[model samples]
Target: MSAWFAGLLLAAVSVLVGCRIADTDAVTPVPQLLAFLPWLLVPTGTGLLLALLGRWWVGVVWGVVVLAGLAWFIEPYGKDSEPSGPAVASFRVLTSNTQFGRATGALLAAVRQQRPDVVFVQECDNRRCDIALRRELAVAYPYRQSVDGAGSQGSVILSRFPLEPAPGVPAAMGMPGAVADVHGHAVRLQLAHPMPPVPGGLGPWRRELERLRDFAAAGRGTPTIIAGDFNASQDHAAFRRILDTGLYDAARLAGHDRAPSWPSRTTPVFGVQIDHVLLTGDFSVTRARFLTLTGSDHRALVTDVTLHRR
Candidate 1:
């Protein structure tokens, strides 16, 4: 019986290690696996504590390792810091994860009222990607690029300033998408929606992260802004990998780290902030907050940023 228990414990530890390795940029689908790690570890840790305590040092060591792993794997916020960079006039950015096409009217109203210089909309289908939305948005934004269609699972960017398409960055497992350089600033904008790992769902989220990191790294000379639903939260290791690549999260920088965005209608006891806007280089965030729900499952995120001309 002792031997059997020992074998079980070793298997549990091995599985934990495998999970950690998979969650890295290497395996690409590990982020999805991370959601289950907490529940998995609880039983294993209890067994280890009860059985190994006779060997007190062994139990202590195991406890430390497990706790450390949890801390490293789960991160809920980007690094905390006050806004840097010289103060430039604030420019508003509206980022919304529209549930395909349900809240077009509400979105149009927000756009008309706020008139943000840049707008990022996710989960937009081609049916709603018509001239009316464009016409209404055109009052404030003159340039736009959208990938809306029956098979569309990405986003669009509308800017008041001219936008030139930058090179397409290869995604981890899907076709590459476009990134654009907004003229008149030292910043470039990348809009993406990486595939979520839902069991047999899109199998590789890491590939998306790696692709985005590679694209951001190539443009390190200029400040870059990446906005999207991302699907994964800041607490996951996948998000940490992106942060490790020197990008700053604009929402956290603006003091909105606890802003929960998912499930707009029903507020959970503990909310999740899955929508995000991350930045790199010299741009500073002035404000980042969730907008009122407009009949979508996810709330909108708006950020005001200031970029210095150096």
Candidate 2:
């Protein structure tokens, strides 16, 4: 019975590994499953131990193979990279979802403590908390663009520098973007909060991710940054497709991608890194880390980036 159970567990893990590699994430449950894909290593390792105790050589070999494949999928995350060249401009960014405006005060305090040049906030609903945050934010960030939405749909961008609404860019649901004038150069910023893949939301979630992919593909000519609660992780095929468009994740570059950024209620070990800061053009991330928000489910992602001139 132990051998049989181990074999079945290994088989299920193999199927999951295959689906992730085949990019079947657009389908329901697959996207949801992949969100916690890295966690599968625990069970696969347990199955290998069980197989060994039962003298199930076939199960042990299969378990080893499956575990190896799973490791390959998770290896790139948190990998460090060396800086390339001279910096034209350097800035810090803080991005977070405020949990329907519940974390507004904490978010504001983080802004003052981190002193980020730009802030990307999702779930900036028009409640008393959010309204107060915006009013307080304007004292430091004179340039801003915000669109209030129902519940957790609103998005906002606040910058210490000048900002202009980006023109001619295609729109995705709940994504608010702008162009910031940093040292006389234009840096495009997009605050993204795609629909989560809950029941009845999978289609919209896929479409929203596709839209961001298209947006990234078309904006290769300029320095662009997209930050917020992506509602998808690097394990998702749609999110990986966006990276294929030439954007680099800040956490990945700085060797901190493994630090989970969601479910702030629990310890970091129990959460997943769903919030992200992605960049394109000649930019290099110098530092990346996360900060817990008082009343939010998602932890804020803070990154330092150096933008290189062409």
> lDDT of each prediction vs. the true structure?
0.64, 0.83
Supply the TM-score for candidate 1.
0.74
- What would the C-alpha RMSD of candidate 1 be, to one decimal place? 4.8
Candidate 1 — number of clashing residue pairs? 3
TM-score of each predicted structure versus truth: 0.74, 0.94
- Model 1, 1-310: lDDT tens digits are 4334544664565465566656542343444444444444565566456546455555546655765666555444456534455655557778877676566677787777777888888766557733446767776776776664533464577887677766544443222233444445545777767776565554466667667777777777676778877776665666667776778877778766656777676543345677788877466787877876566887888888776654
Task: List residue ranges in candidate 1 displaced over 4 A.
Answer: 1-30, 33-77, 81-85, 168-183
Per-residue lDDT over 11-46 for candidate 2, one digit per residue giving the tens place of the 0 to 100 score: 878878988879778466667878888899988998
Clashes in predicted model 2:
0
Q: Pick the candidate with the highest TM-score.
A: 2
Best by lDDT: 2
